[model samples]
Target: MGPGRYRFPVTPLAPGQAGPRPGGGPLAWIRAHPRACDTVLALAVFVAILVGAMAGPHGPHGPRFGERDLTVTTAVLAAVASGALAVRRRFPRSVLAVTGVCTVLELLLETEAPRAPVACSVVIALCTLAARTDRSTTWRVGALTVVVLTAAAMLFGARPWYAQENLGIFAWTGMAAAAGDAVRSRRAFVAAIRERAERAERTREEEARRRVAEERMRIARELHDVVAHHIALVNVQAGVASHVMDSRPDQAKQALAHVREASRSALDELRATVGLLRQSDDPRAPTEPTPGLAVLDHLIDGFVRAGLPVDLDVPRPADALPAAIDLTAYRIVQEALTNVHKHAGQGARATVRITRTADALTVTVLDDGTGPDGPDAPEPGGGHGLIGMRERVEALRGTVETGPRPTGGFRVHVRLPLHTTQATHQAGASGRSCRTGETG
Candidate 1:
């Protein structure tokens, strides 16, 4: 009834199914067939009542049977009281009412010497009702059964008001209600624990899926940066080699060499990025260190060689950036420059600037070329370069600004925190595997 406490319906087991009973035994079989158990219980109680009714401890020598005659009325009342118990679980309240009425009749009719053992069946039926129904209903029904039966035995029977038989009926009925309530409480507690465990398992599985998705995105961004950057340089160099193959033999050969170098670099990076998918114990896994500001010069040289002259300005800071921030900054600069080379028209130049503050490291890339608004702009969301950049920066809780400059050309400004959280450090470690390669 409380929040988040859901009660699911139980599904019945099919034939030959072990169900929840993996180790089947006597108790397991009894539990699996409730109606059969109830029937057996009812028959056993009937025999017990009849045996007790035919004997008494007031015998001359000791307790003995055959001293008192078993009358037809006594036999019929015992049979009726016990028979109703067989269907107690299906109709618990109705069974309890029938058993209680029979007990009252047996006590009232035997006025000369009352020895009604039908109260045994009433006790069993009351217990069944209490176990199946709620507390309020159990209290009301149990109290009524006890008061009625005890009053009948004391008022109409030959026994005194405070006789042991009258008191025993009240005690048995009260104990049955208490015992049944205990069983119901224990069952509810166990069910709640199982539901909690199942919910936790579902949460753990969802978290694993989320982590997998994040890893895939990280690998994708790394692959895009590596392939897009080097391939653009390769395409430019190959075109130059073809354009001046005859007129300028020396320039053509130099461009061919640059193309070879770019292609080799692209292959090495591709191999490293794909190697992340391999098992950790793989022998051919790449061990190359990830690129950052330390290799900015090498990255710029490749662009300058591909006919895009670039100006770089970076000041050394007091402390180094965190691995994640350093990697993100390097990738952003790489991606922004790659975009410039691919979309900017001929004779366009780019400027790269790095500014370090107390808490942040900012990298700005500006190109004096056709911006996104120009005819050369890629369609919105069509380019994965910017999307990858945004994802990387956001992962480290950084910011990225990309738009056209006020005067002309396109600009990409990114601010990365020098000191990142522990979660960012862990992400950097995971991503390091895919980013490891030779950038040259």
Candidate 2:
């Protein structure tokens, strides 16, 4: 596991486990019942029609279908239509076919007894088909069922072509189908919106995680560079101390002192690096100062001691630059000089220039040495020093340019804003005074 990568748990049934069953427990139980809800509704309709039959007159022209013994036949047709409702959800087309046939048979019987049971069954079948199938299928099935049943009633039944009972069947069936279709469409639309929202949320979370990981990696890289540079110097001094212990005891003592100083500095920087992991409110976490323009002289002296010819030419500023801008300028100069020491030939002369204006400050470093040329000049492949300088400057809403100068040398130019220069000046002055007192 690298420093920044995170692992999240995976659950197999997570989505399904997130909620109760789709229709609520009771509705789901009802739907799973052996008889089905539609069948129960159909049976209720049958009982109501039977009660109406028993209450009516039984003589000729008195709800008994004109003295014909039609009770058995009507009862059988109603029973079959009611049974067909049980399988509506599983086989909606089949249920519709069976109900359609039963409807025709009931019309032929021409019973004055109520036809509500048959109509109820037809409504259930149409609702099932409309809810389950696409609009095209629903239209085809609904239209065919309506046309056939209406034709049958007018051709063989006692009712007139436009009788209320006949028209009632058409209206109720159409309304049930339409209502069922609307419910299905609304459910589908809601589901689509929910899926899109979830996907967007997941994308945003992944992006946030990626950014956090990248930041951690950047911090790790900085820590590595700081530790490596300081430790290398300490190691060199310690070697000198060991080599001169007998022949040059005083020089060896001085080298040991330098080693101790280097070790202490490394420890402070390492503590600062580790302190980044602490919460913002933690008291013991270090609040290390960032190196800024105030440190330019020290930085130049280090390169000079390292056997590089450097000339620093910074104009006196009318006002102090912003802390961020000052830091950018210092780092740009530091990285440029470091590159000259690493890439330029021995004894190269480098010039650093800083110019401040009302709104912006520009820092430019030019080295007269046999550095990289042509396209290779801009590629700081092995080291991030130049890249770090560029990033620092740009983060202050500034610009940076680095390439081979036309005069057989390398150059880096940077411009930074001075919008917050006054505040930064006050803070830096107070901080510097405090640091000086502590050192004293």
Candidate 3:
């Protein structure tokens, strides 16, 4: 035998048998064998009816067994009525009609005071009919059964029309219908509860999948921003080092040093971003703080060293900004400056400006270079920098605009709420508003 394979004995099952269901107790056994249960019920009802037919209240003391003879006719009618109950669930109306006929005959043909025990089977049949049918049908059939049986017993029985036995027939049948209706209602209520629970389970699973997809998108955007900005710097420096290795040895050494620094920064940022997906118990995971607007000066210096001079204008806020807004602001500036360094022609200087209002913080990046529509523009589908910027802004309920400037340059502008509560307030009013023109 193969290591992953096994053999087991095959047992044959009887036709119409599906093996035992998973459960226990007497109720489970009854549910598994309904036909056998119905047979037992019929036997019990037959015995009770036969015993009742052999007893009478005409005894000197009270009702006594054998006071009345159990004739062949009485026994035959009792057997017929009880036998009909075996198929009550499958054909409730038919069973009820058969039992009612037997009961009518036993009442109308009796020579003495009628003690028709066959009516017991009719009671059971009426209950089954009501339980298996709708309320309107149950009501209609129940009223007819009660009226017909009670009237037959009153008008044709040896006893008077108002005898206690006549009225007892009406009471028993009415109670059976009510009990059956209650059982039907309980079953319906339980079914409704089960359906609602299943719907809630499906809803929770869908919500979990949606959140997982969003998180993946966010991580992908972070990895892209980190790699593109640092790798662009490294590429430029490596080119400079190779071009001047023989002619300008000292300048080549300087360019190589910048390349090492940019690569180191890239590795550190990548480790931190990737570490978020590791297990909490992993000891090698990095715990460095996320970069934000506070490091704007250092970010700009890297670009300046890479040969693209940049100008900065920012004022310190009175209070610290939220963590999400701070990170988004930093990434937007990093990606925009990286685009300028890579695509903007030689001597194409860039400018970054930050303005803080009472309720909002705005960031604007401009470069006097060949814009997206210019001859130097990269082909369509070249990058996702502008798309990532829009996604980050929209997540915080902010707005972003990207396009070619009128005066032969490119522009990236964004407005973010100062307070988290303000973002929540405006989220419904202007949902996911992002105005984009072209990618760099």
Best by TM-score: 1
Clashes of 3: 0
* True-vs-predicted CA distance for residue 46, candidate 3, Å: 2.9
If ranked by TM-score, best first, what sequence of candidates would result?
1, 3, 2
Q: Write the per-residue lDDT of candidate 1 for residues 62-173, one digit (tens) a residue.
A: 7798667777878999999899999998888899989888888887787656876888998898888877777888888888887888788778654567877778887998
Q: Candidate 3 — which pairs collide?
A: none
Model 1 RMSD vs true structure = 6.3
Q: Output the TM-score of candidate 1.
A: 0.85
lDDT of 3 by residue, 212-239 (tens): 6666777788898999999999998998
Query: Which regions of candidate 3 are displaced past 4 Å?
Result: 1-23, 57-62, 71-80, 281-283, 371-379, 418-440
Q: What is the lDDT of residue 261 in candidate 2?
A: 68
Q: Evaluate all candidate structures by whole-model CA lDDT and list the values in order.
A: 0.81, 0.66, 0.82
lDDT of 3 at 138: 88
Better of 2 and 3 by TM-score: 3
* Best-performing candidate as measured by lDDT: 3
lDDT of 2 by residue, 1-440 (tens): 22474544332222112212455576777646746666677687666545543443435555543333337766777788877777777788898888888877777664564343366677778887887778888888888887777666656654466766677777887887797687667656655656666666667678677556545654654464455445545655676679889999998887777677657866877888788779999999999786678777876765564457789888865666666567557656766776676577555899999988888898999988985456434343555565555445544656777878887888888887777556444432222111110000
